[model samples]
Target: MTRIIQLSDPHIVPEGTLCYGVVDTGKALQQAVATINRNLPLWGKVDMVIVTGDITDFGTAEEYARFRSIMADLALPVRVVPGNHDLRENMRTAFQDQDWMPESGGINWSAEFSDFGLICLDTLVEGHHHGELQPDALAFLSDTLKNLGSKPVVVGMHHPPFNTGIIPMDINNLRDSAELSKIIESHPAEVRLVCGHVHRSVTRSFGKAIGLIAPGTSHTVTIDQRVENPHTLSLEPGAFMMHEWRDDGIVSHIIAGNYSDERHPFTTPV
Candidate 1:
């Protein structure tokens, strides 16, 4: 089985208040890490870790450094793409060894692990929180899929390519998503397309394939059935996704830190 761990929308803040709101990002994220480490089933099989984007509160160099420091304990292989909140120059400067990072200032990349392909897309459009794959990126994806047709493929990004009717969020979806969906639908060989930035867990159909939105490690956006202007910020447990790929298919799980009643070793009868 091929194991892929996904950590997204961490929104690691600098040294003060939360990003754009009133969430306890630092504390929530800490809980998220603990949750993943403890809840992951078959932990020994985890092979690769992919961080979709929004690694920092802002696209600052120092924030990346702090983010890296916080991730030091994972000791697993990881790759990243930029989010709307990220800066390409600063990200490159801080994470120079991430070979998958695109040259030419794009930061998109494709990688291989255990005979499976991991495609990281650059969705940051410089000045917008909404993401769209440009012509070059679309071409890159088509070519990559054509060349590695039979491999189990996992694509990660910072934006959901579909509309969820959450007025504020859907307005910021991937621009040419219909075309992209058709491309993915025609390819039955692909396993899954995973993304972040929505701060929620959802599954949508893309032709014959599945698109997954992993939860954020920092905060969450509530779901409202009457969501006309539906934009809300609330504290949810931090979460990360674990995907295990075998001959049967890809089995995925989301692990988080907020276990309501799991007793820690240090917790006595108190």
Candidate 2:
């Protein structure tokens, strides 16, 4: 069985600084890393760790360095895509050594496993909060999916193609996704779309495929559904996702960043 860990929206800031003058994102990510490493024995072998996006809060060199420093302790291989908060050039320079980092153009790539394939696309539009897939990226997705040939696959991106009733975030969703939807609908096998940006776990149907949005590693976008409510962030417990390839299909589990106590077994009548 192949398993992949998804860590999203860490939003790392420079040392000694707190994100939005509240959440200690650095510490939050540390806890998340410790949590995953501590629980690895229970999950067995994890193939790779994928950080969907929003790695840094300000997309600075210092932030990227800090992000890497925190992630260094992870025991599994790592792959990443850029989010709105990420500066593509800075991210490219930071992960240039990694094979998945593209030397030029968008930070798009793919990985193939025996059971399924993983394709990560770049949806970052610099100097803007909203996301879009340019012509080149669309071409890449088209070619990659064509080559994968009808096996179950997970398409990872920074922006979700569907809305989650959060008006603030819904407005920034992947715009002009009609072509993207058409592409996925044409796939012969199951196609799962996994994304991050909203800082909350949301599931929705995107065309013929399932769309999943992961929670943040530090904070969450407040879940008020009222259209008039202003956008806000909450100090919610951090979490990550575990995507495993099961015999039937891929199963995703959300794991919290920390626990208050040790596990307890159920009591039985004597």
If scored against the real structure, what TM-score would every candidate get? 0.88, 0.98
Kindly list the per-residue Cα lDDT of model 1 for residues 1-270, writing each as its tens digit: 678888888877775766776866666666665655655553766677778888887888778887777776565776788888888788888878766665575777887767578778888887888998877777777788877778778888888888776667777877778777766665658558999888888899766768899988877877653657648876766677888776767878887646764556865675
User: Candidate 1: minimum summed lDDT over ten consecutive residues — where?
Assistant: 33-42
Instruction: Give me the candidate number with maximum TM-score.
Output: 2
> Compared with the true structure, what per-residue lDDT tens digits does model 2 show for residues 16-111?
999999999999999999998888898899889999899999899999999999999997899999999999999999998897888899999999
How many residue pairs clash (N, CA or C atoms closer than 3 angstroms) in each of the candidate models, in the order given? Answer: 2, 0
lDDT of each: 0.77, 0.92
- How high a TM-score does candidate 2 get? 0.98
lDDT of 2 at 56: 96
Displacement of residue 254 (Cα, Å) in model 2 is 0.8
Q: How far is candidate 1 from the true structure (C-alpha RMSD, Å)?
A: 3.8
Q: What is the lDDT of residue 221 in candidate 2?
A: 98
TM-score of 1: 0.88
